[model samples]
Target: MTAARTEQAPGTRAPDAPENDVVLRLEDLVVEFPAGGGQTVHAVSGISLEVRRGETLGLVGESGCGKSTTGRAIMQLPRPTGGAVVFEGRDITKLSAAELRETRPKLQMIFQDPISSLNPRRRIPDIVGDPLVVWGRRDERAKVVPEVLTAVGLDPEQVADRRPHQFSGGQCQRVSIARALVLEPEVLICDEPVSALDVSVQAQILNLLEDMKARYGLTLVFIAHDLGVVRNISDRVAVMYLGKICELGETEELFDDPVHPYTRLLVSSIPSMETVTGADIEKADRGRGEMPSPVNPPSGCRFRTRCPLATERCAAEVPEMREVRPGRFAACHYPMLEPVGAGAAVEGA
Candidate 1:
C-alpha cells in the first residue's frame, strides 16, 4: 500500500460554489429496479458526486457496478427513487415532464454502442438533426447538421445522404457524437464511448471528444471500466464497487496511491508490459474472487465480501466515505493508507 501524502485537500469545496463553476451535482442519489419475486436490485446506493464546469469527472467500475445507472439518473431518464439531482442549481428530479423535455437539450448522453445508437432507416442529417427538430429548429438543421458533421471529422456533403448502414463503427461513433453535439449541450454524459471501438479508433474518438469539449465548452461525466482511459481523460476519478463509491479523488492521486483495497486491486489488475506465465498467474490469483450479486450484496460494506483487508468491524458497520487524506476520500474500515498521525499507522509502516 502507498503512504498518503500531505497535500491541500482537493475534495473539500465551498458549500456555495461560484454559480458558473458547478454544472451538475448529485446528492445521495439512489436508483433501484424491480427484479420480480419481490426482490429489488440496488443499482445505485446513495452516491453523490459533482461535475465542475469544463472538467471531466470519471466514474469507473466493473460491469454491473451501477456507473451507467448513476449517469442515467442524473439525466432523469426514469427519475431516481431517492436523492436530488441538481443541475445548474436547480433540482431537475422535481421537474415535470414538460419542463424536463425543455431542459433535456442542455444535457445529452452518448451511449456505449455507437452503431445501435443511430437510426438505421434515417439519413445521417435527419438522425443528427433529430434533437434540433424536437426543439423546433428543423429549418436551421440544414446549417447546423453540416457544421457538426464536419466538426466530428466527417464530410458534410458526402455523408449527409448516407444511412447508418453505410458507415463503419468508428464513423458511426463520430456521427453519434455529431448528433449529441448538434444541440450544443452544456453537460455531456459519455457512457463508455470508446469501449466498443477498435483500440486505434478508440484513440481517435478520445481525441475527438477532447476537441469537441473545448469547442463546445462542455462539462463531461465520463463513465468507463478502463482505468487507463479514465485516467488519461479525466481531471478527477471516482471509484465504484458494487453500488457505492469506495474512493474519489484527483485521477493521478487516486491511481498513484489508491486507499481502498478494491481500488488497489483494480489498479494492480491493469495489464503491464511484462508477460505473465504459469507461476505468476497462480500467485496473482491469491485473495481475488468474482464480484458478488448486487441483489444480495454484503450487509455492512458492500465490498467486504471480496476485500482482502476486511475485518469483523467491516461486516458489522458500514464505512462512510470520509477524507482519508488531503483531497482523497475512501469508505473502508481500514484504508490502505492514512495521513501522518491520523490514526493507526499505514498498514506496512
Candidate 2:
C-alpha cells in the first residue's frame, strides 16, 4: 500500500520499493503432508509471492488454512515436503546443515506464543543473547543484549536475571522478539506474533515491530487471522482459504475493492464497528462457521463448501488467478469485484 506502481493484476514490482530493497521471494511454494493411506494434505498449495526489503507482507486466513504452515515452511523449521523458499536469491530447500547455519543469521522467526516460546529455565539476558551466542558473537553479546532488551520495551537491569515465568505474557513476547532480532536478521517470519497477547499488549508489540522494521530494514512475513491488524501493518496482503491464495493486492486496494467472493465474505465478517460488540472471546468467532477440515477439503475451489457465491463450476474447477485491474489478483470463475460506480458486488461474489 506504499504508493506502489500498478502493472497488470498482481503486479510484479512494488510501489515505493527502493532499487535494492526486494528481499524474500516465495515462488510456487507448496507444503504437503504424506499420510499412510496415500492421502496427502496439501497444506499450502503452490502459492507464489515476494516480500520486499523493509516491507511487511501479511498472510491472512482461517486457522486451518495453512497460514502458519507457510511460515514454518519458509523457515524450514518443520521440514517442507515440497516447493522452494528463496531468500536473497538463494533457494534454501536444498541447503545442508552448515549452509542452513550460515543462513540462520539472516532469517529468524518470532513464534505465536510468548510464554511457551521462551524456555522457563533460561534467564532474560541468556535468552536474548542466545542468538548472538549461536552466531559466534559471544564477546559482543554483552553489549548487544542490553540494547536489544531496551529496544523491545524491557528493562535490562531488573529483568535480566529472571526466568520466563517471572514476567507477564507481553513481556515474554518482547523477550522472544529481542531474542529473534538480536542477530539482526534481514527477514523475520512472525507466525501470528500478536495473536496471543492482550489487545493493549498486542498494540505495544505491533508498534515495536514497526519501529524495528524502520531501524533494522527488516522484510516481514506477518501471519495472522485478523483483517484490521493486517491493514494497519502490511504493504501487501494475500488472503488465503483452504490452502490456496484467493486474493492478493496492496492492502488498501484489496480491502477497498476485494475482487474475490471469499474475500468479500472475509471483509463482511470483520466485527461491525458500531454494534454493541460481543464479548472479546466470542467476537472473532461470531459470524464465521467452523472452517472445513483440510484432510478432505471441498473439491475444485476448496472454499466452495462455504462460499455463498459458489456455483456448479466452482465445485468442479480450480479458478485461475486473473488480473482484475491494476495490481490485483483474484481466483474466481466469476470475479465479483464491485465495478467502479457500478453495483457494490462482483460477479457471483
Candidate 3:
C-alpha cells in the first residue's frame, strides 16, 4: 500500500507537497449523480487532498460524506462526474481504458464488508486471485496467493480451499487484506475496512494493515466514520463536511489543536480521547443535526448550520483551508484550538 514510487522517480515526495510527495492527488474533485425527478445528487464537491508515499491520509466524516465515492473515483470504478485523479505523475482521470488497465495493478481498494466484496460462490484462491486473472498475470497470482494468505496470519492450505462463507468476519477481513497485499499495490483505498467487524476483531485487522504497510512500503487513503479508529492508524487526518474538507493536519497536531468547530465536535464524540492522557479535553457539548443532503448543499460554508462560530461572513463566503500551523490546515472563519490542561479555554471568539 506504499505509494513510494512503484517505479523510481527523480525526487522526494515530502508530505503535503501535493505536486511532489503525492502518490495520489484529488484536485477540485466533484461527482454528481442523477437522482431522478430532475434532481442532481452531489456526492462529492470540490474536494482536494493528497496521499503521500508511505503515509496514511485519513478521510473522516459522518456517513454519506462522499468518502467512499472519493475512493471509487480513484479506482475509476464508476466514471467520475468531474475533476482529476492524478496517480504517480499521470492523470488517471484522463487515461483511456487501455492505460487504466495497466494502472489498476498498482492501485487497489478494500471494501467495508468482506462477504459482499468477495464472491460467496468463489473459493478463497479464486477470489483473492481474481485481479491477476483479469490482468493476465496468472503466474504471479498463484505464487503470491498462498504467501499472502500466510502473511495475513491464515493457514494457507486449510483456508485456501474454503469459500468466503466458511470464514468468520475477522478471517474474511484478513483474506481481503491478503488479496490487497498479493497485488503489492502502491496505494490502498480502505473504505471502512474494519467497521463491520467486532471491536476485538477490529484491532487484529488494524494491526494487520499496519504490518502490511510496513512490509509492502505502502501508502493509504483510509476512510472511516470512527474518529478513534482513524487516530490509531492515520499519519494525517482530513475532516470532511458535505463533500468538502474542513480541516486537515498531522494527526497529533490536529487532534490536540483542532481549530474547526465541526472537528472539535468529532473529537468530543470519541470516548478514547477522554481516557487517553495528553489528548486535549473538549468539555463543551457538540452540536447535533443529521448532515444535510448533498443533492443541494448549503451555500458558502456547508457546515454553517451546525458550526457555533458561524457568522455572516461564514455563510456569505467560502472559507479556504488556511494554514493554521506549518502543516495543519482548517477552514473556519474562527478557529477553536485550545491549550492542553488550560482550564478549557474557548478560542477564536
Report the Cα lDDT for residue 295, model 3: 84
Top candidate when judged by lDDT against the true structure: 1
lDDT tens per residue, model 2, 1-349: 1232222223344545553565776666788897668888879887777778778999998888999999999888776776667777677877898898799789999999989999899899998998777767899887999999998888899996799999888889899889988988999999999998889888998999999998888889999998889989998998988888888889988876676767766776777664322222122224257777777778788767766566899888988776677777778877765532344454654
lDDT of each: 0.82, 0.79, 0.80
Per-residue lDDT over 234-333 for candidate 3, one digit per residue giving the tens place of the 0 to 100 score: 9999998888888888898877767677887787667863542222333334346778898888888888877655678877998876766677777767
In candidate 1, which residue ranges exceed 4 Å CA deviation?
1-20, 274-285, 338-349
Runs with alpha carbons beyond 4 Å of true place in candidate 2 = 1-20, 36-38, 274-289, 339-349
The segments of candidate 3 whose C-alpha lies over 4 angstroms from its true place after superposition are 1-19, 273-286, 337-349
Alpha-carbon error at 4 in model 1, in Å?
36
Ranking by lDDT: 1, 3, 2
Output the worst ten-in-a-row residue range by lDDT, candidate 3.
5-14
Residue 239 lDDT, candidate 2, scale 0-100: 93
- Which candidate, 2 or 3, would have the higher lDDT against the true structure? 3
Write model 1 residue lDDT over 77-192, tens digit each, in one string: 77999987878767788889998888889999999999999989999988999988888889998898999999999999998679999988999999999999999999999999
